[model samples]
Target: MNSEKLLAILKLQATKNVGDIIAKKLIAATGDVEQVFKESKNTLHKINGIGTHVTDSLFANENLKRAEEELHYIQQKNIGFSYFLEDDYPQNLKHCIDAPILFFKEGNIDLSNQKIISVVGTRNITSYGRDFCNQLIEDLKDYNPIIVSGFAYGVDICAHKAAIKNNLQTTGVLAHGFETIYPKTHKKYISEVHKNGGFITEFWHDEQPMRENFLKRNRIVAGLSKATIIIESAKKGGSLVTADIANSYNRDVFALSGRANDIYSTGCNNLIKNNQAHLLSSADDIVKMLNWDLSKTSPPKQKELFVSLTDIEQKVYDYLQQNGKQLLDVIALNCDIPVYKLSSILIQMELKGVVKPLPGKLFEI
Candidate 1:
């Protein structure tokens, strides 16, 4: 068939016993995908995680046709891929073990960059998060940086949108395939991204967006960039996954401060406390990390913060700012308020024009 190296890689990705167990082991023993097929089944069993059945499949190379089919489908969709050893691959991401063997992309982006920062957080973002993202990315835009993110919701959308608005290249790594975009609502922005920036994925076409894919996607978000910034993430947010990956990769990760006692902000604060991430209150912190000379590009126009309040109101306001619209119960949990008295406070806050209720029992600030 005169199959090429890319085809071989496609087949390797198609093999059995390759799901999180023996994929790395086989790569270690065989030294690469092509060599894995060359090794005898008996010989392959010597690797730590590989078993007789896995070695047998390694010898038979049963998935070659499946891979060829996948490659054909991938080609039909016009998705592009870059191997770790290929010239087009992001050199920084190459060092990551969990790095995709092939990155499927559709967009305009200078994949090669002096610096990249992955900005991520919750999908239910607040005005504060929106403001933080706007200011932080605006400052870093002059660096002509590549911004990496998952392109999901909340902070990811904000980051990508800001980068595009600033005319900076932004890459959104996807959890699903190019064949289908999860949360199709993002098509407008993602299309614009492809026109300028690009979308990337490891999974081939027809791959479902299993929740784990998001976890897998976060590694690329963390690895592809020089640093990672958490604008507003909850205690168990996926942005923390990116931070964890960044720390593992020995990359710089900055987290913006959230209001005291807010669940969404607790993750960033904990990251700062554990010394896993540095504190970031303004755009200056990000610029300092890249050490870029911003005199080159036009400085980003800043946003105006509307209204002010005392500490208690600020706390309530800040909580609303991160959660977008939340139910009264959610508000209570977020603000750590006893349900009994939270209603009067919320009502007062609403009257003050600090928060407003929406249909379906939600409030936005």
Candidate 2:
């Protein structure tokens, strides 16, 4: 919010390839960033990483003009902006060495909240994945932890929608920028998020949603939250990147287990095997890992039923509950029910609030 400090920092950020490290070094020695800009090349060259290319960039009129234009465009949007050196920037994020000097934010989500959790998973979610994500949202909303997720398909979209449905605040970390929504069909959902929750990115106004941007975006999503839940993921996906970043930040990363042979669950299994993530069998597991105050999390009401059930629904439910997590196909085979019939039955149970869906076609009863 400090315009002078923000503009100064953005000015540094605009210097191509002379990013956080070089900027910090120059700013520290000069005692003020603006002072560094005023100094001659001889003074700039005294710094360890300040070479000829950086010196040229430091004095570039074009870079300075672009920075000013970015600032002007930001103001025109009426969006709230912050600088890392200024007050009201997220304290946790500021601790990172590569923290963005500038952050563009506009929405109702509060970053200063006492507790936050990031939920991420596969875009190709299974029925079980859906139910799993729903239960997490339902349980955590009353406690008011800020839900952070990539606003993509599957679990990310589900997490955001559930939080909004419960009137809870959430934040979506986008790979691109405000210029265009990726997975453009999600425009409606992202639109709702802007009004209710918010969208965030480290990218500039018109940055493309390149394949690599998603990996970089995951760093912010992971860095911003206390913990991350990966409901389902393949051996390779953005969710794995988020988990790795969370670990690097010393945040707890959790991967819910699914079928052993299922490709979608393979990344999660590898995470657990390689010790990047702990297994999250239940919502309580996540709560306990974060050491969150149990009292603040008031789960939704559930009717205790002694109602007798036919052998199939009972079989399916028992399989899920006993294993703590199960995919629909896995459950169907285990319960000896046909896959088609099991689908409808699981849907009914989900509506009844007995089971939860997860990413990568899974369910937990």
Q: Which prediction has the highest TM-score against the true structure?
A: 2
Q: What is the lDDT of residue 101 in candidate 1?
A: 68
Residue lDDT tens for model 2, 1-365: 45666567778878876877688788888888778788899988988878989989888887778778777878789767666767687777777776666677767757898577888999998767877888777766656678889899988988887777556688998888688788896775655687667987777787889998888788888878888889999999889988988898888899988899988899999999999999988877877777877576676445345645567778877777779888878888888889988887876565445676665788886
Could you give me the TM-score of model 1 versus the true structure?
0.77
Report each candidate's C-alpha RMSD, comma-separated, in the order given.
Answer: 10.0, 8.6
1-365, model 1: which lDDT tens digit per residue? 23476776777677665653356566767787678777777777777777876665644545777787887887677666777666888888888877776667787867777678889998878778887787777666656788888888788977887787666788989898777877786765666688668888888788889999999988889889888999888888899888998999999999988888887898899999999999998877777776866776566545435655667778878888886888888888878888767776765565344676554668888
C-alpha displacement of 176 in model 1, angstroms?
0.7
> How high is the lDDT of residue 61 in model 1?
48
The models' CA-based lDDT, in order, is 0.78, 0.79
Off by over 4 Å in 2: 1-4, 296-365
